[model samples]
Target chain A: MVAQAAWVVLLLLGIGLLLQNDLGSRLALFGIQPDLLLGALVLLARRMGPLTGLAVGFAAGLMQDGLMPDHVGLNAWLLMTAGFLCGHARESIFWESSVASALIVFLAALLHNFAQGVLASGFNLNASLQLLLRSGLPSAAYTAVFVTFVAYAVPRVLRGRD
Target chain B: MPAPRTPSDRAAFLLYIFLSFVALGVWLSPFPSPRAWVTGAASALYLPFRAVSKGVENLLGLVVEREGLLTEAAELRRARIGIQELREENQRLRDQMDFARRDSLHLVPAWVLAKRSDRLGSRVLINRGQLDGVRIGFPVIGREGLVGRVDALEGHLSRVRLLTDRASAVSASIDRSHVDGIVEGDPVEGLRMRFVSYSADVKPGDVVVTSGLGGSFPPGLPVGRVRRLGLESGGLLRRIEIEPAELPERVQDVFVLAAGDSSRGWGFLWARPVAPTDSLAESVRTPRVEP
Candidate 1:
C-alpha cells in the first residue's frame, strides 16, 4: 500500500514537471491544455475504492498547494470531493469500455474545473458557470482525450501483469 | 453501488472530515507563508528536475544557433564568389597595362559597352569615339593580338567589326613561307586565306600574320595558326583555314592604335620585320569604307 502511494506521488510529480516546461505548452490544444492530474485522480477513485481515493486525492492536493500557495488547501478539499464521488460509483460503472471511461473522465474534469473556479472566485456563481462554458469545455475535452488512452492501457497492463 | 457502512467505511468518513476541517483551518489562518515547510520539501524533491530543465533549455539554444550559422554560411558563400570574379578582372587589367607599356605603342584603352552577333557575324561597341582619337579603320587589339578594326564612330562611342565578321578581310601571310594572301572572314569557316596558290609552301601549324599589304592593319601582327590545308576545286589555289588570333566573342577591354605610321615597327609583336608590298597595298583598299 505504501509503495502504491509512493507511485501515485511520483506520477503527479512527473505531471507537474511537464506542466512547468516549454514541452508542455507545445502540447496544448487551442490554448487549452489537458489536465492529466485530474484524470489520474478520476482513475484512482474509480479503481481503488473511496478510502484509498480520498487519501491519495488529499495528498495530491497538498502537493499542488505546496507548488501554488495562493490556494493552500483549496485543492485538497476539491480533489478529495472529486475522488469520493467517482469511487462511490466505482462498483457500478463498466470500466472495460474505453468510451464510457473517457466520458467519466470528461465529466470529472468539467466538474473539477467548475468547482475550482467557483472556489477561486469566492463562490461567485456567474463567473464559475462562465468558466464551465468557455475554457472548461475545451479543457475537459482535452483531458478526456488523454485519459481515454490511460484508461484503455492501464487496465490491460495491470490485468496482464496480474 | 454504495458500500455498506462497515467499520472501515465509517472510519474513512471520519478521517475525510478531519482532513477537510484541518485544510479549512489552514485556508482561514492569518499567517503568511504558512506552507513554507511543505513548499521547501517539494522544492528539494524537484532539485534534479530543475537541472534537467536547464539542460533542455541549452539544447534548444543550440538548435536555434545551428539555424543561424547555416544562414550565415550561405551568405558567406555568395560573397566569396563575387570576390573571386573581381580578382580575375583585376589580373586581366594588370596584364593589359603591361602589354601597352612593353610594346611602346599609342593605345586608346576602351571598355566594350555592348556586343551583338547575327547573320552579319559579330560587332562590339566601345566607349571611345572621334573625340577620343578613335577614327574609322583604327586597329583594335586585345592583350593577345588583332581583335578588329573600328567601322563607325559617334561622339562618345564607336563600333568595331570583329575579324570574324562576314564583311571583314585583312591581308596576311604565313610567317614561315612569307607568302601573302587575303585573310577574309566567312560565317562557316572562321578565317580563310584566299589566293595562296596550290604550290604555296604552307602547312598546318604555320603561324599566319598581317602582311601589311593593304596598310589597313599593322605588319606581322599575330593573326592565327594554319589549322588545315587543301587544294581548291580548280586546282589553282590552296584552301587554307586560319584559326583566329583572338576569340571575337570574349573581347571585353581593347586598345585601338591611332591610325597612321604607328604600326611601322609593330612587327616585333610576332618577332618579324615589316615586309610591305605597296603594289598589293594599292590593289586592296587602305581603309574599307562602309556605312
Candidate 2:
C-alpha cells in the first residue's frame, strides 16, 4: 500500500513536470521537447518490469491525450509503445554502466521520434523535414542526458528500499 | 534464475493494443463536437486551482509593481498614458452604447479563460456558456475588431473558433475596391484571401472587412488587413495574404453578439428593394386594375 501511494505521488509529480513549460528548457537546448514522462516510464519499467510499466504508460498517455488539444489518443499510443519497447529492451540487454544507459536512451528517443513522425505522416500532419531535424536531434540528446541520471539512480533507490 | 512470463504481462499488452485501436478510431472518426459536459466539469475543477495560482501571481505582481514604481518611472509614465487611453475608451464605449440602444444592436461582454492547446488550431474558451445565452455560431469580437465565432457551448463555458483556424472561412471584401473574396487560414499561419479576380486592385495594407454575404457574420466588422498579394502560377486568380485584426495569442476579453434575426439591424438595406416595386407593378399591370 505504501509503495502504491509512493508511486501515485511520483506520478502526480511527473504530471506536474509535464505541465511546466520551463521544464523542457531546463534540459533541452532551443525549443525541442525531450519526453520527460518517458524517462520516468523507463525508470518504472526497470524497477517493476513490463506489465506495470505498460499500465502506467497507458494511464499517463491517456491523461496527456485528453488534456491536450491535439487529436485525442496520439500520445497514449506512442507512450504505450515506448513502455513496451523499453521493457523488452531491458529484459534482453545487459547494460552495466551509466554510459550504456545513455546509449539506450538515445536509441529509444530516436525510435520514439521516428514512430511519432511516421504516425504524423500517416495523418498528413507532418511539418517540414527541416523542422523535424532541428527539433528532433537535440531533444533526443537531452533525453539521453536525463536518462543517464535516472537509470543510475532508480536501481540504487529500489535496492536500498528492499 | 529467469522468471516465467506472467498473465499480467499478457493483459497489459492486450490493453495497450486496445487503447491504440481506440486512439486510431478517434483520429479517423469525424471530429467530435466539443464535449460540453467534460469541458464544464474540467473548468469547474480548474477553478479552485486557477484561483490559487492567480492569487500567487497577483502577489508576485504586487511586488513587481512596487519595484517598478520606484525604479521604472518612465515605464510607469507610459502605463499612466495607457490608463488614460483606457479611460477615453470607456467614455467612447458609453457613447457607443447610447447609439447602440437607438440602433437595436445588443453587445454582451465575456471574459476569456483558456486558449486552445493545439498550436495548429485556433480556439478559445470563454467564461460565459449556455447559461449566459451564448450559443454555437454566435459572433465574437475583440476591442479592435471581429475575433471569431462560438463553435461549442457548455453549461458555463463556450469555445470560440478564431478566424485564423484552417477550418474557418469568412467572406470579406477590400474596403476600397469592394472586391469580394473568401479569407481563410493557411495551414502554416495567417490568412489567405482566395477567389479574388486576377485584375482586382488589391494592395498590401488594404483593410478587409466582413461583407455579410452569409448571415453567419454581421456586415462591416473588421476582419483583417491585406499584407501581400500574389498570383498563382496558373494565373487564374489572385491570392491576397492577410494579418488578422485580432491577435489570437493575446486576446483575453471579447463580446458575444446576441443571436436573433439579423434583419433587425439590416432594415435600411431592406428598404432599398421597395423602390423597384412600383416600377415592376407599372410594367406588369393590365386592364385588370378595373376589376
Candidate 3:
C-alpha cells in the first residue's frame, strides 16, 4: 500500500509539472520532458505484472484527461490499453537493452497518440492524420529518450527492496 | 517457474479484443456526438480549476510587479506606458461590446487555454462552455479576423474548429473584386480557395474575408490574403492559396458570436437581391450562396 501510495504521488507530481507548462518550457531545449510518467508505468508493468500496470495506466490517464482540455476519459482508455500491450510484450519478448526499451516506449507512445487521433475523429472532432503525425512523432521520440533514462535508473532504485 | 495462463487469461484476452473493437466502433460511429457528454463534464469541472490557476498566476504577476527592481525613472515610465496600453486594450474591448450591441450581434468572450499541437491542423480550446452560453456552431473570431466555429461544447469548455481544418469550409470572397469562393484547408498547412473561375481576377496579396454568404460566419471578417494562384489540371477552376491573416498559433482570446435564428433561410443576410429580370437568376444565385 505504501509503495502504491508513493507511486501515485510521484506520478501526480510528474503530471502536475507537465501541466504547469513552465517546466516544459525550461527543459524543452535539453529534450527532457515529463514522459517519466509513461516510463514509470512501463517499468512497473515489467516488474509487478499486467493487472497492476493496467490500474496504474488507467489512473494516470484519468489524471491526464482531467488536466488537459481534450475530451475526458480518452487518455485513460488509451493509456490502459498501452499498459496492457507493454505487459504482453514483456511476457512474449526478451528485450534486455536500453535500445529495445526506447523502441518499445516509442511504439507505445505512437500507438497511444494514434488511438487518440482516431477516437477524436470518430467523435467528429475534426482531427486529421497529418496533424496526428506531426504531434505524435516528436512526442514519441521524446518519450523514448525519457524511457531510456528511466529504464536505466529503475534497477538502481529498486535493487535493495525486492 | 513457467508463467501460468489460465482459462481466465483467454477470457480476458477475448474481452480486451471486444472492448478494443467497441472503442473503434465508437470512433467510427456518426450518430451520438462523442463530445456531447465528455465536453460538458470537462468544461463544468474546469471552471473552478481555471479560476484558481488564474488567481495564482495573477498573484505571481503582482509579486513580480512589486519587486521594485526598476530603480531608473525611464524603466518606471515604461511600466506606466505598459499599464496605459493595457487600459487602452480594455477600452477597445469595451468599444467592441458597444459595436456588437449596435450590430445586433451577441458576443461571448472566451479565454483560449490550448491549441492543437499539430502545425498543419487548426483547433483550439476555449474556457467558456454551455454554462457560458456557448453552443456548437457558434462563430469564433479573434481581434483581427474570423478564427473558426465552435464544433463541440461540453459545459464550461468548448473546442474551436479552426478555419484551417480540411473539413472546415468558409464562404469567403476577395474584398476588392467580391469574387466568391470557398476557402478550404489542405491536408498540409495553410488554406486553398477553391471554385474560383479561371476568368476571376484573384491575384497574390488579395485580401480575403468572409462574404457572409453562409449563416455560418458574419460578413467582413478577414480570413487571409492570397499567397498564390494557379490552375488545376482541368483548367476549369482556379486554385488560390491564402496565408491566414491571424496566426492561429498565437491567439489567446476569442469572441463567440451567438447563433441567431433568421426568418429567411441560411445566408439570409447576404441573400441575393431579386434581379426581377430572370426568375432563374434568384434561385441559382441563392442556393450557391447558402453555406
Candidate 4:
C-alpha cells in the first residue's frame, strides 16, 4: 500500500513538472495544450479502479491548483469528478480493447476541457461556446489522439518485454 | 464485472470528492502557505530545465550557424568604430543641451519564466524577485524599450503587468511634439494614449517616450509609436492609439530598472515649455486609472 502510494505521488509530481516545464510551453497550440496530467489520471483510475484513481486525480489537480493559487481548487474538483467517471466506466467498458480505452480518454478529455473552458469564461454562454469550439475542442482532440497512440503502443511493448 | 469497491474505500472516495467541492466553493484561500511552498518548489524545479534548454539552444546555434556568428562578429567590429564616433557626438550634444547624465540607473536582468495572456490579465513571471532586489512598481524594459512594471513579488519570482494589460497606465509624451499624455492599455488596442490636449501637435508615426512624471520609471525610455490618432470622447482628450515598442507576447529577457536617480518631478521636462492650457482637466469625469 505504501509503495503504491509512493508511486502515485512520484507520478503526480512528474506530470506536474511537465505541465510547467519549457517543453509544455513549446507544445502549446493556440494557447491550448493537451492535459497530460489528466491523461495520466485516466489511465491510473481505469486500471486501479475508482478509489486509487480518485486520490491520484485529486492530488494531481491540487498540484495544478497550487501553481494557480487564485483558482484554488477548481482543477481539483474537475479532475476528481473526471477520475470517478472514468473509473466507474471501467467495469462496463471493454478495457482490453485499445479502441474502447481510447474512447474513454476522448470523452474524459472532451468533458474536462469544455468544463474548464466554461468555468474560466464565467459561464458566459456565448463565450463558453466559443471557447469550447476554439480551445476546448482542439485540446480534447489532440489529447485523444496522443492517448490513443500511447494506449496501443505501450501494452504491446510491455507484453514483448514480459 | 468486478464487485464494487469495499464500504471503507467508497466512504473515503466520497469524503475526498466532497472536500474538493467545498474547497472550490470558498473564495478565500485557506492554504496560502502550502500553495506558496508548492509554487516555490515548481519554480525551483523549472530553473534547471530553463538552464538546459538555453544551453541546448546555444549549442545548436553554435553548431548550425558558426560561420554566421563569426561573420556577425567581424561586422560588429567595423560597426564598433563608427559607434564610438556617434557616442562622442551624442555626449557632446547632451552636454550642449545640459541633459542630466543617467549614471545612477541600475538594472537587474531576468529571464521570463512564463507569459500569462489569459482572461485574468497580461502578466509575465520573471525569474528575479524580492531576493534579487526587485521591488514592486520597478519599471521593466526590453532591448528596444519599456515592456511593463513589476506588479507582484515573491521570493525568487516577480509578476509583471505588461503595458497591454487593461490595468496598466504610464506617463508618456511624443518625442517630436513634446505633448504630454497618459498612455493606457486597452484589451482591443494594445496601447491607447489618453488625456492628451486636443490642441497638441501629435500625429501618427511619432515616437513616444516615458515622460518620467511618475518617478517609478526612468525618463526617455521609448514606449511606442503613435499608430493612429482617434478623436475619442470627441471633445477634451485625443485617444491616440500606439503600438508597443516591444510586443508583450515576444518579451523574453528583460531588465528591471532600479532608479538611482532621485525624484526630479517636472523639472526635467520643464526645460521645453509646453503649451499652457485652460483648467478644463478638473471638469473631465474620467476615472483616475492608476497603473
**What CAPRI grade goes to candidate 3?**
incorrect
2 or 3: which has the higher TM-score?
Answer: 2
- Leading candidate by TM-score: 1
Candidate 2, residue B67: how far the Cα is off, in Å: 10
Task: Give residue A9's lDDT in candidate 4 (0 to 100).
Answer: 73
Best by lDDT: 1
The positional error of residue A116 in candidate 4, measured at the CA in angstroms, is: 1.5
Provide the lowest-lDDT 10-residue window in model 1 chain A: A15-24
lDDT of 3 by residue, B1-291 (tens): 123386645554555555545444433446456434444554454455557667887999987866655455668799899999999999999988755444455678888988883634567888887667665566788888888887665567777878887678999999989999999865475788999999998889999999988767778899999998899679999989988876777778899876332222112342232233222223335432213
Model 2 ranges off by over 4 Å:
A1-22, A26-28, A123-129, A150-162, B1-4, B31-291
For model 3, the superposed segments whose C-alpha errors exceed 4 Å read A1-44, A56-76, A92-97, A114-135, A150-162, B1-34, B40-291
lDDT of 3 at A55: 58
The parts of candidate 1 lying over 4 Å away from their true place are: A1-24, A153-162, B1-4, B50-106, B109-291
Clashes per candidate (backbone, < 3 Å)? 0, 0, 4, 0
Tens-place lDDT per residue, model 1, B1-291, is: 244487867766777888888666666667756567666655666656666777887899889999999998998899889889988988898887656654444688998999866665678889987667666667888877788887667667777888888888889999999999988886677788999999889989999998978767878788888999988889999999988888777789999876333333232342223223221222134544332
**Per-residue accuracy of model 1 over A1-162 as CA lDDT, tens digit each:** 989868866766655555534444677877887877678788878888777777777777767776677787778777777777787767778876788889988998898899889888999999999988889988898888877876687778999999
Better of 1 and 3 by TM-score: 1
Model 1 clash number: 0
Clashing pairs in model 4, backbone N/Cα/C closer than 3 A: none
lDDT of 2 by residue, A82-141 (tens): 776677567677756677767777776766676667676773435534445766667777
- Residue range A1-162, candidate 3, lDDT tens digits: 989876665445444434434444554634534455566677666665565555566656555555563555666667667766676678666667778878888887777767778776774434646755667777778878866775676776798577
lDDT of 4 by residue, A111-145 (tens): 88777767766777788878778877788777767
Candidate numbers, best DockQ first, in rank order: 1, 2, 4, 3
Q: Which digits, one per residue and each the tens of the lDDT, describe model 2 over residues B91-199?
A: 9999887556534445669989988635457778788765666655667999978888876666677777788887788888999889999988664657888999899
What overall lDDT goes with each candidate model?
0.76, 0.68, 0.68, 0.73
